[model samples]
Target: MTKIVVDPITRIEGHLRIEAEVAGGRVTDAWSSSTMFRGIETILKGRDPRDAWYVTQRFCGVCTTVHSIASIRAVENALKIAIPSNAELIRNIIIGIQNVQDHVIHFYHLHALDWVDITSGLTADPAKTAALAASISDWPLNSPTYFKEVQDKVKAFVAKGRLGPFANAYWGHPAYKLPPEANLMATAHYLEALEWQKDVIKIHAILGSKNPHPQTFLVGGMAIPIDPDSQNALNADKLAEIKRLLTKAGEFVEKVYIPDLLAVASFYKEWAGIGGGVGNFLSFGEFPQQGGGQPWLPAGVVLNRDLGKALPVDHRKVTEYVDHSWYEYSGGAGKGLHPWEGESEGKYSGPKPPFQHLDTSGKYSWVKAPRYEDQPMEVGPLARLLVAYAAGHKPVQDAVNGVLGKLSVGPEALFSTLGRTAARGIDCLLIAREMPKWNDQLMDNIGKGDYAIHNGEKWDPDRWPAEASGYGMHEAPRGALGHWIRIRDQKILNYQAVVPSTWNASPRDAKGVRGPYEAALIGTPLADPGKPLEILRIIHSFDPCLACAVHLLDARGNETLKVAVR
Candidate 1:
């Protein structure tokens, strides 16, 4: 057996290292580690509960708005405060836009290259590529001349040897299965997606006052002042602009993104059985009804691939185990503790850098093993799709069925890496379709002269009880995300966030049950252990964001570890 390590996995948000034991051309065992320690939960101690959202939003630049939403929801849950109708509608629109924008970025910018071979695009016939693009969807940019121009641009960049974002990739790797024409088409959409994302963020700027990390969230509701007459606030013109942007984004998802995903999946049908880890799935329901009723994305757990029985997720049953993690639990090293009583103490006792393999018997990752009902549950788009489909959500069911029909694959195929990628595209369409409904609802509420955006009754700290605890959760673009908070005297007593990456990228637990990332790697066939593009494909499908999972920095901001991969 030989050990293969890909440390500081590229094209991702932060540091993540995957070490796998390969024997007979297949991965036998794997360890997923977040190589740095981020003490966001530790920093939140004794801070004002209302300020938690702002601080936690810094957890990750890409997921800024998600952490903020969860933090405010946690505080509101503790106070038993219900937001006004307009606030709910506004928050939904903001989050929906975030979902659409983030998914597009993930596909075109981050994960597309894993399947597309850029160098092969040079050999593609532009006319054939245009035909392929037109067959997928009636996206108007499919002219042969347009594709020829895109090919020339790529050729020029290669000639200059300045690939920029396209540099250092495992180009022409055997794992990339798309034809040259398909690759060229995907490459064109990738450039188009870059322009599309810019317009999408304008919607965020109009509503949330900023794009990356919006400051619109308040503990009880949103902070956007509503005024039809004033041009400064969320006025009529601003609403119209948002609607127009939503319509544009919806067209991109339905026409370009979803079709491209299906076209790619058709070539890699064998992937439908690979990387299906920890059949149990979890989703903390999100996007509540107009008045805080049933969530649009149903919250539940599907265990052992039994789709017929979707069980409700009880946050109380969630616990984190630090057996193979860097943190130490007060109760013991391998003991599982609820988040409200969670601890984030750093203690790195693993083999140092330049090491051959991880001491799987010892601590390996910065991410603690989070288990729901003592089982490692998979989270993210696949989990949300499964939970919603099992619950008979009409829109979700229809969207999923439409894709499955196009791919000509049964629902069982939804368990693999390709399915996970497809689920994100399908969910993006669902959220984009709902955006207009939410905008219309907000407008109707304003027309009725009900324009309240916040409830200041709980803003004062003195109004809080001596002690309270609550869980704030959202079906973030990456999957089930929850923030557990315990407050006392209006200050945060304890805080813990079990983010999506924490659930998917975690290591083994006390019972020696492998986490999703680890389990998915086993039995995977690697064509070349040295290049290991297959490993990246499966892992990137989870959209690992270790910045949200772990962090570390010295006082002088110097580098921490010096490592070598063999």
Candidate 2:
């Protein structure tokens, strides 16, 4: 057996690394060591719980709104505060818009090249590509002339030795299965998506006061006020503008993104049998209904890949283990602690710097293993749709069944790597359609002269219990994101954020159970050991964000371990 290491597996900004043991051109065992510490939870200690939403947003630049939402919700959950219907609508619109945007970005820019051969796209006939694009969707840009223009631009970039984002890829790898024409079509949309995403995120700027990290999140409710006549708040003009932008975003998802996903997936159907890891799924359901009941998406768990029985989620069953991680729990190394009792003390015992292998025999990674009912489960778009579908959510059922019919595959196919990718597209389509409805709801609330954006009933800390603990959850673009907090004396006592990547990218636990990333790679067939693009397809499908995984940690000013992949 030979060990292959892929350090910083991300396309641009990377923090996760996978070292696989390959035998007979297939992965046998894997160890995923990823580290990027923000120490945000530690910083929140003694700080005002209400202010955590702002500080936690800095956990990662791309995950700005996710952390902020989770933090505020945790504080509110502890205080038993209910936000107004207006605030709920506004938050839903922002989150839905971001989810739609993030999914599109993942497919076109981040995960596409793994399936599309950029060099092959240059060889495609523009006329044939245009025909292919037109057959898939009636997107107006599907013209021979337009495809020709896109081809010429890419040709110029390659001629100048500046491939930009297209650099660093295994251009002609055998694993890329798209035909030149299909590749050309996807490449064209790749450029178009770049322009489309920028415009759609303006929804955030209008209501959020800024993009990346929105400033409107408050513990009790949203900080942005609503008034039909005011220029400084959510007004009639702003509401109209939001609906218009969301409508256009929906069009892009249906016409360009969904069609492209199906096209790419048709060529890789065998993947439905591969990378089916753990066979357990979790979702902290999102897109809540008014009056705060079960979220529209439905929160549930599916164990052993059994879709027939969708289990209800009990937050008390969630626990984290640091057996293979860098931190040490006060109870014992092998002890599993719920987030409220979680600790993040950093202890480095592996080779310091200039080390090759991670010595997997001991604690090797900074990411802790999160388990539900003592079982490691996968989380993200695929998990969300699976749970929702199993729970009899009609819209999700229709969407998943529609995609399964299009692909001519059974529900069992949804367990693979490509299935995970397709689930993202389906999730995007459903939420994209819901964005306009949310905007309309906010508009209706405004028309009724009931523009309450906040519920400050528990804003002051004076009406506090001596001790309280609560957890917040959000079905982020990546997966189930949660923030657990304990408030005492109006200040944060112990805070922990068990982010999506931490759950998906977790290392092995005390019982030697591998996390989703590690398990998914166990049987992946690597076409080439030196250039293991297949392994990447599986890892990127999880959308590993190490910055979010290695969060809530305090290294205590220890010397940063010099990271080396061998």
Candidate 3:
């Protein structure tokens, strides 16, 4: 048996390294390592509590809204305040827009490459690709030349001396088995998705400003008020365009993306059984409203492995163990605590000869192992699907059912790798369709003289309860995201964050239980270790945002990549 490693897996948002114990034809053990650590939590120390909203959002450009929401919620929880109904609605719309853009990008550009070989498919008959695409969807612009245009653009990009985005790609690798026609169609959509993604991002900027880190979200309410005189009138024409585009995107998912996914998945049905995890899932829930009442969606963790059914996720039950990390904190493996009170006092320094192993049991990722109720659990689309499935959401249930049926898998198969991936596309479609309704509602509220901003004087830290701490959790596009903060003497003394990827890609815990990504990688048959399309397929299925995972910097404070293949 020999172990093959793909460290610092490229093309995704963050840094990750995958190691698989390959014996004969399959992987018996796998480890997903998240290297690098950005002291974002540490950055928040001594700053105004209200500033947490803006500062934390910088953690991820991709899912800044979720970070903003969670940060604001943390301060709100500390101050014991509730936002107005209109504020909740606007926040929902902001989050929803990012979700739409993220889903579209993941489907076309990131994950699609793993399943469909673009270079191979680019050579196929554009006419056939266009015809097939047109037959599957009602978009009026599908044409052979349209596909050819996409190929031209891709070739242009490569020719322009900038294939940075397509780095490490094996353009014509034989294992990338896909018809040229199929690749052409997918390539066209990939280019289209890049454009569509920017359109959706505009919603964030108009409301927040900037792409990754939005500016409008504040602790009490939206920083940007919606009155006509506040800045400008709510442009009905622009809002309508956004709504129309979102609807069109949803339609495309149903008619184009879903069908394409099904057809391609048919050619790679073996993936259906590979990358199975520990059958555990977790979601902190997202889209918050006033009080504890339901927002557009609900929050909770599905500890099905323990309860045999999804249960209410308790934020207080989540803990982080740094035993495997390069930190000096010492305690038992399972300790449920918030980030604010987290202990980050260091015990060891760089190249600390005592700890260099990549295994969590000894040496591994800089990311701390995050556990719910003393156990590792999966997150992201699959977890959300199971939660939504258990919650009995009609649209989610129906859409997932359709995907499973197409794959010829039973409903119970939702726990597997293939189910997680397909479920995400369906989730995106459902959420995209839901966003416009929210936008309409928010606009209506504005028409009624409602503005979400809460302009009261900032709360006094002295007025806060003595020694208060809590966990603020929200769902990001990647999956469940949370931060725990503890405040004493009116300044943050401790801060810790258990990002979505920590749950999905963490190493083994003290109990020897595999993390979600680790467990998912087990038993995956490798047709060709040299061409790791299957590995990338499962990894991208999680839509990892490594910016939210770990970061490393050199003396100049610039992040550098470390390549170590085992």
Candidate 4:
């Protein structure tokens, strides 16, 4: 048996340590650990509920808007307040843009390196690359000159021995399957997406008054004023600018992003069967229709690979277990507690860092194991897509069918690493296509003079019931994200955020059942355990945001141990 550890996995949002036991070149056992812990929930105690959104948004820079949305929803749920239709429409549009931007960044920047050999792009003929790009989509940027220019920039960076973002990669790893031209095409898009993301984020700034953390959200509705002539409100010029940006984003998703993903999947079709983790999926549902009606993404569970049997989500059944986590639960180490009554107390009882392997029998991670009905379930784009597909959501069904038809694969193929990756691309296209409708709805509401965006009825503390508790949830870009809050006298008593990563990157529970990340690593064949590029491909499919999963700061900032790998 050989142990392969990828400590502080690169090209991810935060610190994650993945240790897998390999036997005969196949992973037989694995442990996923969040080394650091940031007790954000503990800080929320005694704070005003209205201030929770601002504080929670700091949990993750990458997923700031989702956290902000969930935090407000939790407070709203506690107050039993319903936001206006205009507010809902505006929220959906912002979230839709965020999702598209996130998916694009994940594909080209985070996960693309696992598949595309950047060094090989130097060997690609720009003319052939242009032809390949042109054949796939009608993206106007697919030109020989553009491809050559990107290639030249890459060559210059490589020659300078300063790869920067392109540094420390397994450049010629055998697992890389893309052709030279395809690699060059993807590399070019990788650069293009950086610019594309800036434009997408500008939409967020336009709405929220900032990009990383949008401040426009309020407990009742949005903080943005609505007026046709007012310069400070969401006026005609801002609306037109948003439309223009959305159009550009939509064109990229349809023309560049989706096609590039499909092209990559074609070369790595074998991955369609690998990395099928836990087989259980969950989604909290997002993008509600008018009057707080059913969400576009239905909330449900798909158990044991049975897509035909999607059960409606019972939020009551959700609980977090700290049996194998660093935190101690007040009830007991092995007991499961719902988020409303959740406890987050730090207790690191395991071996310190610089260790070879985690004590999987004991506390191994800072992230608590979250179980649905005590069952380990996977969450993210794959879960959202599967739930939507199972519930017969029309947009999801149409998109899934189109992709499956193009790939000539059955639905079962989606339960793998490749499917997890492809689902994000499919989701982007679906959400991008839906963005214009949301914009139209918001515009119609404004035109009808239904410009009411905030509900000041619940703004006063005296309006509270003295004691209240509620859970706010959103199917974030990552997956099912929820924030549970308990308030008394308008002040937060307890706050727990069961983020998407907690569901996907959790440790073992009382029953010793491995979470989604560990389960997915089992049976994965490692071409070179030392490099472990295969493992990265699987984990990155989840698009982990560990900063949201676990948080801590090493005040000393000392390097304890290092092992050189050749």
Candidate 5:
């Protein structure tokens, strides 16, 4: 078996590494690792519980909003404080918009290159690309003239001898199956998405404060005081602006993002059988309705690729193992502890820098293996949709079935890499459609003079129980994100976060069970082991969130790649 290591896997906010063993042109084994150490859990200790949300937002610059929400939810859960109806509606809108924007960015910017060969677009006929784009959707920019201009813009970038965002990829690789026209069409949408994301995320700025860590999150509720008559608060003009932004964002998702996803997926139906790992999925359930009603996306567990029934998820059954991870537990290595009692510390056990393969037999990665009922499970958009579909959610059922019908595949086909990619679009569309309704609901509540956002019932520490503990779960854009906290004397005593990537990108456990990334790669075929584009396809499909991008290293521990950022 020949071993291949991909350190720093993703192009943005990525710090993961994968080591795979190839034999007979297919992967036979794999190990997943994280090159970065996270100390947020330790940093949060002994701090004011109310301010934890602000500090936890630093977990990831890109996923800042989700972390903020998750942290606040944890503190509120611990204090048994329920936010008011207006606060719930506002939070729901922000969460929904965040997921939609992330899904769009993941499809067009991050994962598309694994399928689309941007360099090949230079050889495409702009007119033919226009035809292809028009055939997919009635997006206004489908004119042949617009495509030619887009083609010219790409050609000019290459003329500069640097591809800018399009650099350092395995362009013209054998694994890229899309024709030149499709590649060109996808490239056009990619540029459009860069602009599209910026405009849509203004919802964050208007509602909270700004993007990449909105400042409105609080332990009891949001800091945004809702008052229509007050210009400084959520006034009539700001409300109108929010509604308009969401409406435009929805239009883009429906016309451009969803169309591009479906178009790109058509040529890769075979992927419906590739990279289906662990076959156990988890979702924390997201977008709860006002007044503690059912969440728009209910949480459940699907085991063994079973779509017929979704077992109810009990957060208590969630456990983490550190035997194969870099950290050790007080209970001993390989022991499973739920987040309420979770303990972690930075312990670097891998070989020093400039070293060859990791000591995979022992502790290798910084990511801890999270299990549901002692079983490793995959999380994120696919898991959320699968759980919701199994629970007979009509909208999710219809959206998933619609995609399956368009692709001419059965429900079983949804268990692959391509399906995972497609689920994000389905989830995006559903949430995009629902965002306007949420905005309208908020507006209606404001008209009814319900300006209460914070409950403030248990906001005071003087009324506190000496010790309290609770966990918060949010189905962030990538997957199920959970934060557990223990509060004592109005200060944090213990804190732990088992994020989505921790579940999917974890290494192994005492039983030698591979995490989702490692398991998914076990049977992946590599057309050329030296250039493993197939590996990128599978990993990108997971939508990994780690550190930032960097160059690759050869198996001999040589920095064989050098990339320039514009």
Candidate 6:
């Protein structure tokens, strides 16, 4: 048996290292480590409560909105204030837009490379790819010359400056086996989808004033209002355009994205059965409504350890355990208590602990294992889709059932690694189909001139004196995200973030329980130990944002360490 390691898996976000012991053509044991940390929680101390939302969003450029919403909800929980109905609806629309747009970009550009070979494009007959696409999906005609023109455009973009991310890629890796024509078509759509998703974000900037990090929403209500009679009101024309953009996104999903998924699935059918991780799943629910109404998404857990039955998630039951990390501060090996009571002091001063002294039972990573009822669970698109389906969402049910029928697996597969990737694409298509209808509902509310607003009007100032605890939770693009905070005298006293990756990419717990990622990597088959793209295909399928979990060791014959983005 040989231990294979792929550290700093390139071309995606953050630092990730996968070490798997392979023998007899199967991964026997695996450790997935996210080796960095940015003290965003430490930075939040003593800042204005309102500014927490703005600042926390910068924690990740990829899903900044998710962080922003979680921060705002934390503050709202602390203040005990509810946002207005219109504000809630608008926030949902923006969140849905980000979710859909991110999924498109992920499927076409980032994750697709795992399945489609870019080097294959060199041998592809552009005419043949066009013909294939036309025959499969009845796609709008693209002649041979049109494909050539598109190729030249991509080449020009690559030449002008940075190829952005696709630069210096190992495109010619011999193991990449897709046919050239399929690769060409996939690459073409990848470039096209980039522009299409960017346009979707334009709608966000029009309403929220930014793209990567939007700024319209606050705790109690939106900072920007869409009054019918205000000077810069959201006019009918702008509303119509929003509707049009959403409709176009839905059309793209129905016509292009779904076909692309089906087409790509045909070539990579083996993936359907590979990388089946721990089937435990979780979602915190999302998209608020009026009058203490329910959110569009619901919170729940599907535990494969419990035979795939949907389990209710109690916020109070969640806790983090830091037994396997490098930290040995307070709470050495116990349940992950609330962030408001978290300890951040580092106890170690060594580059790497003596292997014999390594705390296998406690302190392995900076990320905490958030156990819902003391169990390792998965959270992401697949979790959300399953929760929504179990909660009786017809669209989610239909789409997921259809995909499962195609894959010919029982519903249990929805909890696996491949299911996470497949569910994300299908959910994106579903969200795209639903957003225009949501926009129309918002427009009708506006047409009725319901411009009422709230700005923390009802909270008692004296009761806000200081020293309070609260929890913030939201469904991010990847999955369930939450922040638990404590405030004293208008300053943050304590803070902890339970991000999506913490749940999905966590290490073991106090009792030596395997994390979702570790268990998922167990059975993955690696064709080449040096270039384990198969392992990456499973890892990146979760879209990990581990800028927070990485750290570096340096030496001048003395131990010095640093933590930063890779």
At residue 458, what lDDT does model 5 achieve? 84
Over 4 Å off, model 4? 554-566
Local accuracy of candidate 6 as per-residue lDDT tens digits, 145-230: 76676667666766686667666555766557678888878888887797888787777876788887887867787877676655
Model 2 over residues 3-29: C-alpha lDDT tens digits? 989887866233877888999999999
lDDT of 4 by residue, 277-310 (tens): 9999999999999966679889999999887867
Residue 293 shift from truth in candidate 2, angstroms: 2.2
Candidate 3 yields a Cα-based lDDT of: 0.71
Clashing pairs in 2: none
* TM-score per candidate: 0.97, 0.97, 0.90, 0.97, 0.96, 0.90
**lDDT tens digits, residue span 1-566, model 5:** 79988766766565777889999999999998887777677778999888888887888778888888888898888888888888888899899899999999988888999999998888999889989888989999998899889999999989999867788889989888899999989999899989988998999999889997899888788889877778889977998998899989989999998888888888889999999899999998999887676788999999999999989989999998989887778778768998889886756667988988899999888788889899999998999999999999999999999999998999988889988999999999999999889889988888888788888888778988999998889999999999999988878999988888989988898789999999998899999998888998999988988641111222233455679999
For candidate 5, the 10 contiguous residues with the lowest summed lDDT are 548-557
Model 3, span 441-462: residue lDDT tens: 7767777876655634446666
lDDT of 1 by residue, 458-495 (tens): 78878889999998999889999999999988788999
User: Would you list the rank order by lDDT, best first?
Assistant: 4, 1, 2, 5, 6, 3
Model 6, residue 181: C-alpha shift (Å):
1.6
When summed lDDT is taken over every stretch of 10 residues in candidate 4, the lowest stretch is 552-561
Backbone clashes in candidate 6 total 16
Backbone clashes in candidate 2 total 0
In candidate 3, position 48 carries an lDDT of 68
Location of the lowest summed lDDT over 10 successive residues in candidate 6: 548-557
Could you tell which candidate, 3 or 4, scores higher by TM-score? 4
Q: How badly does each model clash, as a count of residue pairs?
A: 3, 0, 14, 4, 4, 16
